[model samples]
Every structure is written in structure tokens, then in C-alpha cells.
Target: MKNIQRLEMETKGIALSQQELIIYLQENGLQPHEEYNAQSPSAKKAIYQTALSTLESVANNPEMMRNVKMDDMTVSEFHENLTDRIDQLEKKIRGMRTDANQSDFFMLFN
Candidate 1:
């Protein structure tokens, strides 16, 4: 048996997103099941299962294991990425609100 640490919804103050899982699966060379949409329930399940299998390999699994030489994401880098994503989301929300307000204003004229 292999010791596989299951990833939680939020790990170390960072919320895990579906995109991250898909990336991990791809990095590990697992071909995600394509029958369903990328965000579909069946696709997610298939990706998760493949990842779990890769993590289970006891021997030196270069594909699944993190390579220090290639992987360079530090805490600071993660924080910066998170901040950028939040900023983008905030901008999008603001745009949506402005659009909604404009729509309402136009409705009043008609």
C-alpha cells in the first residue's frame, strides 16, 4: 500500500480549485477521461482517481513526484498568484455591476 495524502477543499489557507487538479493530472501524464466536459462530475472523478494512483506509486515516480529542479512555486509566489486572481475577479464583478446598472437605467427610459 502507498501513503497518499488526500488534498482538502482548502489546504494551508489556499482554496483548492478544479483547475489545479486538472493541471496536476496533466503534469502526472494522466489522460483525463474525455467523455464528459472538463468540469463535469465524471471528468473530475476520473482525474482524481488518476492522481491518487500516481501518488500511490512507491518507487521513484518522476511524473507524479515534485521535482525540485523544475518545480519552483514558493509561498510568496502562491500568495502573488492568489492576489492577482482576486484582483481580476473584483474587476469582473465591478464591470458586471456597472453593466447591470446601465441596463436598469435604459429600461427606465423605455
Candidate 2:
């Protein structure tokens, strides 16, 4: 078995098979290693690879991005959005209450 220990070690000890690496690349909108003419052993190439991997990890984590984006919002903006959602929910609750009251009245009459 061709264990990719070097690649795994480079990626903070996250061991991934060749197939898994290919899938990861695809999921992260990255081209395969074969597509890049990256055969040379250069420091620049290594740095680029590391940055790209970091980007992939960040992109794949939706919750992290959501938190980061939420953090970027101003307090006022966050409050406004929350208020809008709450208003909508309150409207729904009011409508449901009216509906339930009508059903109860109809049941008592029947």
C-alpha cells in the first residue's frame, strides 16, 4: 500500500488517501495536483500549497464562515435582522392563535 505519510504529515497529521485528496480538491473548487505543473521542489510552491489547503479547510467549514460573517456584521445590523425575524415569527403566532380560537369556538358549537 502506497501510504501518503509525507502528504498527511504536511497537512497537520490529517491522513487522507489519494482518492480522498482528489475529492477534497474537487469539493474545495481546487484543481488536482496533476493539473498544476508543480513538479519542482520550490519554497514558493510549498507556501502556495499550504495556503491553498488552508483555504480549502476554511471553505469546507460552513459554521466557521457563518460565525466569521456574523462577527463582521455591525451590532445594529445584527439587531435589525433579528428584529425582522422576530416580527415575522410574532405575526405567525398571532395568526395561529386566531385560528385556534376559531376552531375551539366551532368545536363548542358542534
TM-score result, candidate 1: 0.29
Give the per-residue lDDT digits (tens) of candidate 1, residues 1-110.
11112323212233335566555556644443333334344334433444443333311343322332225675455445545544554454334432124343445465
Error of 1 at 48 (Å): 24
TM-score of each prediction: 0.29, 0.28
Task: For candidate 2, write residues 1-110 as lDDT tens digits.
Answer: 11123334434423345676665544434445533323333322332344345445544555544554454685456445544544554454334432124444445464
Best by lDDT: 2
Worst 10 residues of 2 by lDDT: 1-10
Worst 10 residues of 1 by lDDT: 1-10
- Highest-TM-score candidate: 1
